[model samples]
Target chain A: MSKKNYIRPLDIKHGRIDMGHGAGGRSAAQLTEELFLAAFDNPFLRQGDDGASFPIPVGARMVMATDGHVVSPLFFPGGDVGALSVHGTVNDVAMLGATPLYLSASFILEEGFALSELKRIVDSMAAAAREAGVPIITGDTKVVERGKGDGVFISTTGVGVVAEGVHISGRNARAGDVLLLSGTIGDHGVAVMSKRASLEFETTMESDTAALHTLVAAMLAAAPGGVRVLRDPTRGGLATTLNEIAGQSGVGMVLEEAAIPVAPQVEAACELLGLDPLYVANEGKLVAICSPESAAAVLAAMQAHPLGAQAVQIGVVTEDAHHFVQMNTSFGGRRVVDWLSGEQLPRIC
Target chain B: MSKKNYIRPLDIKHGRIDMGHGAGGRSAAQLTEELFLAAFDNPFLRQGDDGASFPIPVGARMVMATDGHVVSPLFFPGGDVGALSVHGTVNDVAMLGATPLYLSASFILEEGFALSELKRIVDSMAAAAREAGVPIITGDTKVVERGKGDGVFISTTGVGVVAEGVHISGRNARAGDVLLLSGTIGDHGVAVMSKRASLEFETTMESDTAALHTLVAAMLAAAPGGVRVLRDPTRGGLATTLNEIAGQSGVGMVLEEAAIPVAPQVEAACELLGLDPLYVANEGKLVAICSPESAAAVLAAMQAHPLGAQAVQIGVVTEDAHHFVQMNTSFGGRRVVDWLSGEQLPRIC
Candidate 1:
């Protein structure tokens, strides 16, 4: 047909979302066709159905995970909500030693949201997924009245495939397993806090929100059966993640505080904010628990990757009745690291 | 360790959710272990990993869909948020003629919500998934500060498997195809509106929230290739769904208004509210397009299923330049059935 035949192209440059854009009517279609479809253009999504259908790899196992992103500021220094949502779920699937395949995004947009901003976020998400070699095959959009929601909330669900005989789980950690850290911590949390609170610091802080599937794939290849568990310290940070693993495996963790890596700027920011780096979130880093025999191989593989060049062996697992995570401080004191008690910084990821 | 060593049990009967519950600390772990885990217990979830990994069906194609449910009142006469979230995603998967396999639920909870109510919603969601023979394999939870969100917003994503040869899509519709209605329309939308607005009539209305996978499987088995497209008439309701299919298929539709089924109570409720039943959402109903040669067999199968007992032939595909959805009124007049322009009812799910 002709250009005029279709609803006049959305005024994406300066248009504000209205109820009609989410009413599942003509306006919603225009928004989707003109924006989302144009950005996330893939064969599966073009089928025009409630869901997307694609053939799964014949013999590989399917892995699925979902995460809800409610970051305070939609945009941050290093990344925005779009890239964060993509990286967050992709890393979750990779934690299983699985190859990330497809993603489905569901957005809860508040009425009056600017179309231009939405386009920017969607474009960034599409780019992240593409760079990770995963396609956003399907998605859903809903708009809520203003004030009922923050600017936008994105929940990304990803599916991946794991080859046969690959077993990765928090419950697989054993007493002799050594824990490895991918890189410095607390950059993501501090970045978000700085942006949200408008705290100006001498040094610039950026979110470490990068996809880690490649780094994981390389590590898995290096020591496939030796790796016991893999986890990305996000909300409750390294301490909470270690605690979960210890409890799941019925073991204990002993960490050397001096061995753990934290950027100087991040450390100074945390010191100023009275925050604990171990408890601050890190979007790009990971913790790998593997047999002591293969710890060196895994660490070597991690050190070779750009995202994990700062990799180090931070701790070791031990048999303990209490499954506690204790840190031997640089000050010659040891303290038990426990789960977070209450909200520290809300909507960090 | 004894039970006393763990944090005190949550007060399910009278306690309210605080920042601690979502802080990813002791309280968060306790709440997850005592509440969400207790309700959604399964071998996969017990693994305690960032994501769940399961074996994929050998040769079946994977189908995935995600939906954001922000319905109001949390609870309605026929169903609550938990059940609605499950049914909505299940139906979306089934619309692809796939056998629903797994689901992932992500919740964005607002602080200060009641624990008892949250438990009720979780229980209902679990029951719905169990009834449909699908397990929720993985999930994520985040809490926003009070007043930052509605009571709760759920985003459910489902993954299903379709046999190799099965192909169903909105783009498959063709001229001379027959359209089928699974059951009565407007029940779900009206029921929610009634509860939200506190409007009561002589006869009560209830949401038609249900999982339609089994019914869809039966229809696909009986009419395989004959089936062109299967769509759930949700959000923008029947009219919007039909328009979407028409646009996708590059065809038009002619509907007999008298043949479309709407319960008397629902019709009355819509009339009282100055609403059009055609634009009212239905959770338990669907619209199917099939080859005219196989429409009879498909209709017969639908009529036999409990969920599709009220099935009827409501329209037919036609050739038109504009792909307009025009309906013949019961009074022998015809009018264009266009897409929904504005929000008829927001958060109607």
Candidate 2:
């Protein structure tokens, strides 16, 4: 053991967690500050209310989304289950073209969870929720016996309000609409997998786990009527989302490989692992299927937003009973963008 | 093995579940009919929509609630996990004075989860949701590798609309409010524990998992402004719920043990297990704290419902900054109803 351990100020940073952190005691408060408040520092969350209350804007509809995170490892390279949980649900609610607002978190920790690590993850989640302007309010904490549960599982429910005249959905795309892609994909899937697989890459690439609600709001303001559909390509990546839209709307799609974007590192990693980047997951990117007339406006709006800086027009909607998703090749060939049989990188369903 | 195994359609009285029941084919349908539907027969459930659709009444707001069932050993006396899951969430949403409208279900099944068992559960949930005048719509299913997951976990989310001007909460209890309970307590907990402990009761006991929304709606209609607080004593039982309410509303509670109701069988079981029936869980019960003037009206409303036939006035709110929950015993004794220190029984939470 390090000799300095006996002399330090209890080493909140280096120490493992105990029951006191979840005990609603002094340690719990410190954990909240050092870990949660540090990662998420905003006015509403800073208020620390039993429940958050805000003014309801006129002609706006609210969207609420909740998610539970029960990842195995407490700490991951780019993120932990805590922050990912906040971002995952924020994005889900954001995908509806709403201005994401308050968030509620419920944590079920297995007894003996390291307080230090729990604090770290909580801090990260709080930070993300804070920066995204979403406050965590009305949270619940419970502990299960060591053998009865995994380390911890976090469930977050997000609420937001959508402006009027904004209609976006998986089934909104028509036969003549154009589909746009927001930058390179598969970074998130590869990043999480690399950590899980203990693999190393030539260059470190962090998972794209940022909030995209702000970007969505900006696009809605730019071309309110032009947008047809907005969807985050997360679980099954672009292929699955597009396929879902196609099946829901009873339409087909055509994509251009030359226009499609992929990070070189991500592509190489997929090849090495026998995975398809198209089928790989993405947490930060989105697909906007819109009418051709408003394509330029939506593209311009997307590029203006930091998260959508690399946005590009990559496809168009088509009429087909089979609802096949086809993509053009970089080599001037074409192939079907089929449904993923299983998740490219298995984490949780 | 019985030679009758090869014989066609040979069976015992009610029949027992076997491996083939969970295989998702013919036996599944039979199991659904014999077990789930037979117990939960109703009209709306027979339609079997992806989600239930119904019209919302005017002058009322909608409420939605969802709960997940990952309970092991699907079948239990009085109710299995399937029926319990449906009743559990429905009651949560219903306790808020809103009429549950529709429910959405998502199932995560470990590979090889028997089809018959799955069907039985689904049908049971459908029946409960239907009986409660709520529909099951828009469902999802995912299969995980055998070792990666448990047998099955069903998540059900319900939506309901609340009536205007009805403000009910744990924090709404006032200094002079009276507390009332719907019926005898702890039957559900004892029923479940009996099976878990493999103990045969001197008199058979069944769980009290039932819909309380109808009772709640009736209460609201009976005395809209009279009811201040409403809570279903589920996990930590009546004592825990009252304590929470007392803490939240910043008021103390004084209960008369003679006024509280408990089935003799439940009381006997609690004595055998060395557990407090007041702290044991109750699925089909509620604690209502209301103004003294409206107590009779609220009691009358609760009594009109089948779930609240044994409604009783138990206590009253008192002025105390410490928010102590004290009980005056039937034997002219008194004791504090403290917060649950450890689990009454793990996993009941």
Instruction: Tell me the tens digit of each residue's lDDT in model 1 across A1-349.
Output: 1211454688989998887777787777877888998999999888878999887774467789999999889999999999999999999999988888899999988888998998999999999989999999999888888887888899999999887767888889999899999999999999999998899998899999999999998998898788889999998899989998888889999999999999999999899888999999999999999999999999999999999999999999999888999999999999999877687877898
Please write out the lDDT profile of model 2 over residues B223-328, one tens digit for every residue: 8799988778876678767876776677899999988888899898899999888778787888888899999999998888888889989998999878888999
Lowest-scoring 10 consecutive residues by lDDT in candidate 2 chain A?
A1-10
For lDDT, the strongest prediction is: 1
Segments in model 2 whose C-alpha atoms lie over 4 Å from true places: A1-74, A101-108, A137-149, B1-72, B101-112, B135-149, B154-161
Q: Evaluate model 2: give its lDDT.
A: 0.67
DockQ of candidate model 1: 0.69
Q: B86-126, model 1: which lDDT tens digit per residue?
A: 99999999999888889999998989899999999999999
**TM-score top scorer:** 1
Clashing pairs in 1: A340-B25
